[model samples]
Target: MNSTTAVTAASPPTRSIRWALASLSLSMLLSSLGTSIANVGLPTLAQVFDASFQQVQWVVLAYLLAITTLIVSVGRLGDLAGRRRLLLSGIGLFTVASALCGLAPSLELLIGARTLQGLGAAIMMALTLAFVGETVPKDRTGSAMGLLGTLSAIGTAMGPSLGGLLIGEFGWRGIFLITVPLGLLTLLLAQRYLPADQQQAKNTQVAFDSVGTLLLALTLAAYALAMTLGRGQFGVLNLALILLAGVGAWVFVRVEQRVTEPLVRLAMFHDRQLTTRLIMSLLVATVMMGTLVVGPFYLSQALGLGAVEAGLVLSVGPLVAALTGVPAGRIADRFGARRMTLAGLLVIALGCLLLAVLPISFGVVDYIVPMVVITLGYAVFQTANNTLVMADVQAQQRGVVSGMLNLSRNLGLITGASALGAVFAAAGMRVTFVVALALIALACRCARRH
Candidate 1:
């Protein structure tokens, strides 16, 4: 039998499928947790290492940069190699790196270890989604996507509080060390339960695209640095980096078009549906980041709430997201992903419009209500969009496509952090949400067309 038939035949039983999904969900959680957990420990790290804020921030930036630059490349590598094997390797690497991070004696060593950990995270993030199609029935793909989404949000939401507690109990090292046991558990489950790769024979027929991978990685690095450096203040250096990224992207595209086994097929962009979904993902992510960038300031500066109160209020969005994710996926599975995608976009647009127009005199309730709407909508949009994108992709291409989906979201987050944060700083929350509204409107239009 062929690979497809083999994959179908190898589908895990119900109990095994649950174990496999648990592994995938934990993988997603660990990767996302790595992203946010370190943020909460930056100040502690600065104090412990006697490093300046600028130097210590690299602890977070190094991880972010590594993941952003290498995610797509690693995903393509998994497509060429066996995903199960690569994913197992990734989990092991992450676990070892986490231990190194916890034991590092110098700040530089910690940062270097974090970069390694991020590489592992890049693999985990890319492959977990790819594995869904292999592990789950086609009709349950939406539910699987939703569960991953929910775990991701939980990880993000849990990071700050969990990191704080760990730091208080065991110091900054605890934050990194906390994931070690979880990583091992995930590795064990995945190894025993996930369907084995049947593509080793086919893999021998294709050559890995080293040139394309390198060019893409370098281009992504330049772009991420351009968007993340300067602390939201655009400067000559940022401009230069942006220009470098543009040039690198042009070169990469040319290389991709020539490579026998391109990292990303240039022809994929020609698919209107895929292109549209990617754009919508980017736009929605940008708008979602706006709430994160603008929410705290709006709560504190505008409404005069204290830090703790503001944090409590801010947590509501992620809470709503976690609650809504599974239901949203089920809805997508039942009603259709395309329709749910459009509906979700429209809901987000309405919430943004309300945030922009509502009077401040209405106070915290006004903010909370709209944010709940936006978060709920975002949960639905994310699940439906992911389901729609992954549903039709070829099995061999799922890893790369999943990586692209993630890459778009990362770019959007970086852009929003820099661009929308700047907008809020200059023109205030109302204007920022107005910009967000415009973005969601564009996303809605794209969804409609799709």
Candidate 2:
């Protein structure tokens, strides 16, 4: 069958489409929830396990590192195998891992379980976006993307509060246990509603690139560790890891050029549109991370807000993102994706500028209002940018491309936390936001050139 016929054949009825999207949204939510929920319980975990802060931190880091290292590999695997089968397996693995995390007797065991959970999350995050192309109609792609974005934001926004409530009521284990039922529900929906994977000719089957996968995973892990270790203090170890990551990346690229079946085709970067979108995604994510890294300090030190007040104020950004996500997607559908992408960048720049210039005397409203604008723009940009990228991807390459997009965002967040947080520590809130503004400006320029 031709591509058009295959898509038409694969596209379910409107009702089934909604159900499929629901399953995908839940997948996104669960992955994001896994990321943010564990953070709140770190102190409790340290106390419960009688471990040092550094040891307890692995509970969060293991999950993050697993997702970062394996996301691209899993996405490629889904492309080779079947996204539906892999995604079902991912959901099951995540559910089982969560149970294991809750039942673990030691901190080491919990971290190991979290690693397993992160692998599952990596699969979910990678495939959910890829599935969009298969499940949703072309015209409504932005709306579907927006809905997924909304769920992701909701997961992030609610995680800390939900985790706190769960920990308070049922202890740290509850945070992990709570998702088991949700995971089962999501798995059932996905199995029932997601379209079956299309069959490929036997002659066309390509072997998985184990060497490339290993190199890429190792490279990413090294880079992530470089950025995260030492609590933002760049020491000799961080420098060594960074150099190692650089060398690994070079080796990975060389191997991909020589391999018969590469994990990621280096030629994909030659597409200016794809390259620009990935760069823009990374820059935007870095800027967004600035808000997370710098906002609390700005609130507490600059605005003199207490911990509770600062947290409440900080939640505004994700809340705004969640609320605007669907509407932003609908707007992207009405307008062109490129135009909306540019608009979103500009809005984010404006917010950054306001954050830089607005006086401290204006108090919390100043921060909150600008944050609302920034997050709203982020919602629009993310939905439109994702729609723009995925809308044109070849059916066969969707999974890998989706994984690449997510990897860019993850890298950007890691970079922002380390780099932007350093700027905040040294130069204070105003300078940090100025740096954010510059990053957004660069993103806007890239969007316009594209």
State in Å the error of residue 264, model 2. Answer: 0.3
**Model 1 CA deviation exceeding 4 Å by range:** 1-11, 200-203
How many Å off is the CA of 359 in candidate 2?
A: 0.6
Residues 59-123, candidate 2: write the lDDT tens digits: 99999999999999999888888888999999999999999999999999999999999999999
Provide the lowest-lDDT 10-residue window in model 2: 1-10
State in Å the error of residue 27, model 1.
0.2
Taking all chains together, the TM-score of candidate 2 against the true structure is 0.98
Which candidate comes out best when scored by TM-score? 2
Cα lDDT tens digits for candidate 1, 1-450: 533344467665789889999999999999999998999899999899889988998999899988888888888888888788999999999999999999999999999999999999999999999989888888888999999999999999889889999999999999999999999999999889988876562455688888888888888888888888888889999999999999999999998888788999999999999999999999999989878888988999999999889989999998899889899999999999999999998899889989999999999988999999999899999999999898878878888999999999988988888899999999988889899999998888888777
In model 1, the Cα lDDT at residue 394 comes to 84
